[model samples]
Target: MTSIEIRHNLFDNPEVSGTEYKTVELIIKKLQIYHPDILTSDIKDGHGVIAIFKGKKQGKNIAFRTDIDALPSGHRCGHDGHTAILLQFAEYIVSGNRPETGSIILIFQPEEETGNGAKKILQSKVLQNLHVDYIFGLHNLPGYHLGNILFKYGTFAAASTGFIAKLEGKQAHAAYPENGINPAKAVADFILALDSFKNDDISNFKQITVIHVNIGEIAFGTAAGDANVMLTLRSFTNKGMSELINNVTSELQQLANKYSLKVSYDFQDKFNALENDDVCVDIVKAAAKELNMTTESLPEPMRWSEDFADYCLKWHGGFFGIGSGENCKPLHNPEYNFPDELIDIGAKMFLKIAEQAMVD
Candidate 1:
C-alpha cells in the first residue's frame, strides 16, 4: 500500500470540529474494502464509528482506538496523522490476517477536540455490551523523533475543564459614564480577581496547576447588559482541580457581586486524568521491545488532558503518545504533521500489543 498517499488523503480530509462524522464514514468505507466481514456502524449521530474484526480462535475481545476528529483550526494539531495510522492499521489487520487469537475492534471517535465524545460513548450501552478486556490509544508528539514509543505506567495525563462565566451590568454610553453601569470596568476587575487566585503558595501547584481567564467581549454606548469571561482550569489530580475551580469560582462571584453585576457559571467540556494500568503498560512495553524499538520510559506525568480517559474509566486500559519527530512541535499548531514512517511502526506495535494481551 502507498503510505504517502494514505497520509495525504487523511490529512487533506479536513474533518474539523463538530463535523467529523463524514471523515469517520469515509474511513469505514475504506476499511470495509479490505475486510468484507468488518462490521461498521455509526453511534450517536456520527459522533463515533465502531468496527469489529473477528479472529479465528476464540479469545477475549479487545479494542484499539484513534480519534478521527480535527480541531476547528483544522490539521493544526496533527490529527490527520492519527487518522492515517488508524486506517492503515485497520486495513492491515482485517485482510484475511493469520493472527488466530482474539477479535479487534477499531473505533474512530469524533468530537475529541471538545472532550465530549468519549464521555458520550461511555454513556451508551455499546461499549458495555462488547465486554472488552482492554483498550489502547496513542497520540502524536513532535520533538520525540519518529518511530519511537513513550510509555507510562500510571496517571499519564491531567484532568481539565473549560468554563464560561457570564456577568450582567448596566450598559452606558461611551461618552456619558453616569448614564448607566459600565461593565467594562467590572469585567476588568473580574479578570484581575481570577488572576490573583493563581497563587504559588502550595508546593507543586506551579508545576501542576493552571488557571487562564480572558475577557470574551464588552459593549459601550449602551446599558452594560452582558459580559462574559472564558476560563480554563486544569490540574494533575481531582483534588487539586476541584480546589482550584472552587477557589476561582468563588473569587469571581464575589468580585462580580461587589461590582453590582449578576454572575452565572457553566462548564463546557471536561476531560478526566489518564491513569494507565501496570499490566497494560507492561504489555505495550514488551511489544515495543519485541519490535527492537527503544521505548522511552516516561516517569513524569503530563498536565494535558484527553477524552481517552473516559475509556479507561470502564475497562482496564492504557494510553500514550508517540514521538512523531524530533524538535517536538506543540499540539494545536498548524505546522505539525504526523510522521509517515510511524504508520507502519504504530500499526505493527498495535498488532503486537493486541496479540500479546488477548491472544492466549
Candidate 2:
C-alpha cells in the first residue's frame, strides 16, 4: 500500500493513549509485507512494536522511532503522518534500499501523548537486547514552510508534568455558615499561588497553567468539603523543572497545614526535557542538505514536552521537525489533520539518515 493509503487507514481509526491494540495490529499487518524480523512481545504491553532489518554484514544498530498512539482529540497532532512516514521508510528498506553494513531498528512507540511510552520501552528488555547505537525521530511542524527541516542543538523541548492537587475538608450545611471547615478559600489561594510561580524571565522559562478544578457536586444544600486543582508545570531544563516542582510541593504542603486540611498531590504525564547530541544533529543536517531540503535553526527550545525526550536522555539521539505547512492548524487542534505530502519527504529523510548512520 502507498504511504497515503496507510496514513488514511491510521487516521480513520484513531486510538487514544495506552490503548493502541488495533493500531498496533494494523501496523504489524502492514509491516508483515516487508518480512522484516519483527518483535511483538513488547508490543503486547503498552510498549510498542520494534522491527529489525538485518544487513548482509555485521555492524552497529541504528534505530529510528515514531509514535503510534493518537491523541484524545484524535490525530490532530499528525501522529498518523509520522507513523506512515516510518512505515513507508520500512518499505524502502525492504525494497533493496538499506545500509551496506549495520542493521536498522524501527520503533513504533505507543502512549507518547501520555508521556510514559518511552519510559516503559526503555525499561523493557527489547531495546536493551538490540544494543541500539544511535536513535533518531522527527515531528511535523505546522507553522513552517512545507517540507522545511527544523533543528535545534542542546535543549529542543521542555520538561513538563501534570500536577493534580487534592484538598479535603469537613462538609458543612449551607444554612450553618461556619459549621464545617471549607476548602474553597484554600483552593482559590493555591491557584493564585501557582499563578505567582510563573516567571517572565526567558532564560528560566517557568510556567504553571491551571487545567481543571473541582470543588464538589451540584447540590446547593451542602458546602464543598473537598477540592481538586489540576495544573501543568513546565520548564526548559530538568533542573529548573525539578526546582519548580519542589517549590510547588512545599507551598502546597504549607497551604494545607495553614488551612488545617488534608492535602495530597501527584504528578501525571511527566515528560523530560529533550537534549540533542551534536553528532546526531549534524547527521540530520547532513541528510537534509543531501536531499536539498531547506533547513531552519530554531532560536529557542519549544515550550511543549515530548516523550521522545526520554529516549534522548538515554541514547545519543536527535529530534527534528519537518514543516507541515504555514497554513495548517496547530497541533492538538480539533480540526487539524496530518498532511499527506509530508509522507514522501519524511520517509526520504529517515532513509537518508539511516544510510548516513550506517556509513563508517
Instruction: Assess every candidate by TM-score.
Output: 0.83, 0.92
Which clashing pairs does model 2 show? Answer: none
Put down candidate 1 lDDT per residue, 229-336, tens digits, no spaces: 777777665666788788877876787777777788888778777778788898888889888987897656676788888888888887877887786567877666
Clash totals for all candidate models: 11, 0
> In model 1, which range of ten residues has the least summed lDDT?
201-210
Q: What is the alpha-carbon lDDT of model 1 when measured against the actual structure?
A: 0.72
Q: Each candidate: what lDDT?
A: 0.72, 0.87
* lDDT leader: 2
lDDT of 2 by residue, 196-231 (tens): 678757688889988999996678999888899998
How does residue 292 of candidate 2 score in lDDT?
97
The runs of at least 3 residues in candidate 1 whose Cα sits more than 4 Å from the true structure, single-residue gaps closed, are 1-3, 36-38, 56-58, 95-102, 123-125, 171-190, 193-226, 256-260, 327-329
* Model 2 residue-pair collision total: 0
- The 10 consecutive residues of candidate 2 with the worst lDDT sum are 38-47
